[model samples]
Target: MAVLKLSGTLNSEPQGKSHPEAGSDSSLSFLHGTKLAYASNLVRDWHADLLHYQGLKPGSAKLHRDNLLRLLNHARVAPWELQKDHVTRYFESRVNQETGQMLAPATVGTYCAAWRGFQNYMLTAERVNELFSEFNVRPKAFVDDDNSIAVKRHKLNWVPKGWALTDLEIDAIDETFRSEIARAAREHSKSLLPLLRDRVMFHVGIHFALRISELTELRVSSFCASLDADLQHFGKWGVLTVTGKGDVTGSVPMRDPSVHGLIEWYTNSVRQKILLRRKSKTEDDGRREIKGQMVSVSDLMFPSERGGVVCPNGFRKRLADIAMKSGVLRRKLTPHTLRHTGCTLMVPLYSPEIAQKYMRHKHLHTTLYYYHPTPLGAANEVNSAAQLFDDEEED
Candidate 1:
């Protein structure tokens, strides 16, 4: 019997000496003298099949293996011996562990999907008998209306109360970034690059209502100016094309002249300064050569100190710091908060339909969630109605 080694480390190994039937491989020692040994091997084979036949990525295959392993261990049964009752009991136990709180539908669905995939694989491979063929394990329906079984619907009009920034708060945030930029420029600080970059990020994020992922993944190619038929130069009015959720690509018009100027200045001056500094540092260190591909200014919209893609966590932490400095509650400020602020302002400034288009939301309902009516809007409506009544009295 050839022992198969699975990728990633196992949590625990089987106790005592390895069985002769289990072979001499150390990786297979974890399965020695256990009922799960053969089942584990089958899972390893299934992982390979997923990679080779199903064309799944290694990370995805690992997730499948992890999910399947949990089920097998909980049931303590071979693939052929797995019954619907055993699977149901496992799910019930998991639910009970939550102490009366309902498990997320997605969480339960993943468990069911992993089990179903493993069972189907076994059936196809002729490893399991017909008894296990009809085993059906699935998550119960978790719908908002308590009616739909297949899908869970979230409240479309749900937005956190007081999530959007007020005019004063927005001004404070803008001032904080501007102050940082000024300080760095005056001091000729090494932090100048990051200050400039973050300021641009803030403007872009708020203006476009971009998700953090979309904002961070932006490249030089994503932004274009009207004057530059090519991406060679930045113009007064710029357009940014972003790939948002659901793989939908949309063009966001940077109508704010100040935002366009900030981006243009950063691209032409501050970005090059940072890149040059990195290059000089790399040369002085003589450690490892910086790759030619990484030296391009157009590669990433925001590069790290080491000239790599900026981590999303880093972006969040920087934003948090800026928010705190601006005297805003750190918890209240997030990338999404900026997005909400953009959408909130859009409703009053333009229209709900325009907000939907600007935010690139799939549904108008999603846009409606962020449309917070201002007091001024309400007062204006009242005044308009009152004027109409007064005119009627005169007539």
Candidate 2:
């Protein structure tokens, strides 16, 4: 994957300062002459590393790598000289990928955040825009309010959190899967059914509070240990080492009983069938099997029926169907909802602080947003209360 490359000539900015050892700023205009006075080597390194990390994934690595390369080409410049408008344009540039439409402001802002973070870290003290240029774009296929929208950083908690699955919703979801899981386990008798995978995903995501990125990155190697492993032990419960967005690595214990059962079925039963199918090849006798195949856990934690690794999209749809069919979520179930639900469930089990740690949130404010309050209509409540007070006073 290639990003539309950025181009520019290096020309001296009168206001720019040359690096202490370098000659003039004329030779260093980078990022299409977009370097900020605020960036430092540390921030540059981080950005470079993250760009490289993105390459490990299928499509995004190329975009980030291009962005990083653009920045690196300009890395020698001082931060103050870089302009926000240029930064804005860099992020806002349209790509046929992601969506055919113009890029969202939020996406732009996300890129700016990286750019700005690099600048800020270097003490350039620059903001991406006077106001965030980010937008939460709505698709034309479309609707009224953009509830399923991304947000600009209009407020600290601009990512207004979704409430946890209500108790009724949670109960229904559980009920929906309990039988489906049993039926799945029973149907294949020797191997678990597709439904069991969904149920296990529900418990892992909702109960364990994992982002699907973390979940999708899971490998059979991620869960090689015994499901009955001890929690007091280090690296127990399969020791799933997940590299999340921005390429942050976090080791989460795969401790949910449901995840355990699901994995057990996969490793012991489903995996054998998968391996056998993968090994199949039309030989002299016209049959397909890995007669002399080289196999690894990368083979799959949950492979497609064709014995290939399960992609995130497939995992998401299957998980959603489990939620919808089982009724855990009243609305269309998203993989993300499990994360929201996991945070909510943790509220009663843990302090908000501990829950945040479990989720690996960088900010406590973000953690606090996980709790959903019952919305009360302010006007109706006030009017009713005032009327009752007046009636009581007259009596």
Candidate 3:
């Protein structure tokens, strides 16, 4: 039993007595007979649900567990005793220790989501009320709209310069990468391989408008180098297919000759050298069982130095370095920034329907919101409408 303090609160610290009758886990033996221990067990059960029911992979589920643990540790209170204010204060107080900057709204929103999911599970799970009865504390919803930063629409305004790059910016990046590659090749520098890999990732990621997750998930066989010559415009284009979020598969035609050639060179020479260096045995056509279904899995297109999928953090950092060298305004180049650039560039060339399909979005609204953010307001629309009348008068 927990000892009630003079302030009418139970001390969250573990008692000196052990509970052998409860359970015997040597690592957590010190936490036995404490509310913290009970809360930890609840988190373990929640982690299992996240895997079996929510279909989240182990790493993702562990992230949720870690987030909750931070709260439990900070609050120093039992799980059922947690209130909305406790949750709100935790998020509000979050800051980047190194930079001394507050947490991003999007990141705060993700933490809110994890809390909401766990709270929901706590309220509905069988015998949860009975478990809480011992502590005489009723479980309540911890996260609500009052503290949540969740928004239905993208907050592109958060980044004043904007997430998407203009046409000039895109051209500048490409030209800079090309110039750097030429210089490195001429000098026979050791950095050529990494430069080539980053260039391929940039070009392919932008053209495909792929999420960082999708880009990293790409396999060696994801690219189809040839298409039927009888297929008109698509004939000369290669295909880059990826399995995106929610297991939805989509393929986009690779049209840029420069991008196509980069893919070929990287695959034929660079990737082979990486594999040879690591002596990695990952096959192009490997199979794995997922959700009781046999699905094809293979070696990653952009493997790490040790021969695994390239870390997204490392990828982002390298891209940021490239952007810095290119003298781009926004040196932090997230994969979504490239996605926005690709989608924006495609908006004029393709119809909304086509753009939606290419973006692999279930709804046309998503495509429009991402690609057609009207930062300039109706000025462009007004000019275009006026041009129509000018053309008619000339005719």
- The number of the candidate with the highest TM-score is 1
Kindly indicate the candidate among 2 and 3 with the higher lDDT.
3
Compose the digit string of candidate 3's lDDT tens values, residues 195-220. Answer: 77778888788888889887866776
Worst 10 residues of 2 by lDDT: 136-145
Whole-model Cα lDDT of every candidate shown, in order: 0.62, 0.50, 0.66
Candidate 1: where is the Cα deviation over 4 Å?
Answer: 1-90, 96-102, 105-162, 225-237, 279-295, 328-331, 348-350, 373-395
Model 1 accuracy (lDDT, Cα): 0.62
- Superposition TM-score, candidate 3 onto the true structure: 0.55
Q: How does residue 382 of candidate 2 score in lDDT?
A: 24
lDDT of 1 at 203: 78
Off by over 4 Å in 3: 1-45, 66-111, 125-139, 147-162, 177-201, 211-218, 225-238, 243-250, 255-258, 261-336, 347-395
RMSD of each: 11.2, 14.0, 10.4
**Which scores higher on lDDT, 1 or 3?**
3
Model 2 lDDT per residue over 1-395, tens place: 23332222231123454442122222334434223322344344545555564334434433433343344444333343444444433334444445445445455444444454444433422233411222122112111113212233334345664657766776677687776667766666533544555556566677567787666545555543434447534233555655566455655555456556655665676556655655334532322222233444334555545554446687777667666676445566777877887876664455555666677776665655565533453123322222322322110
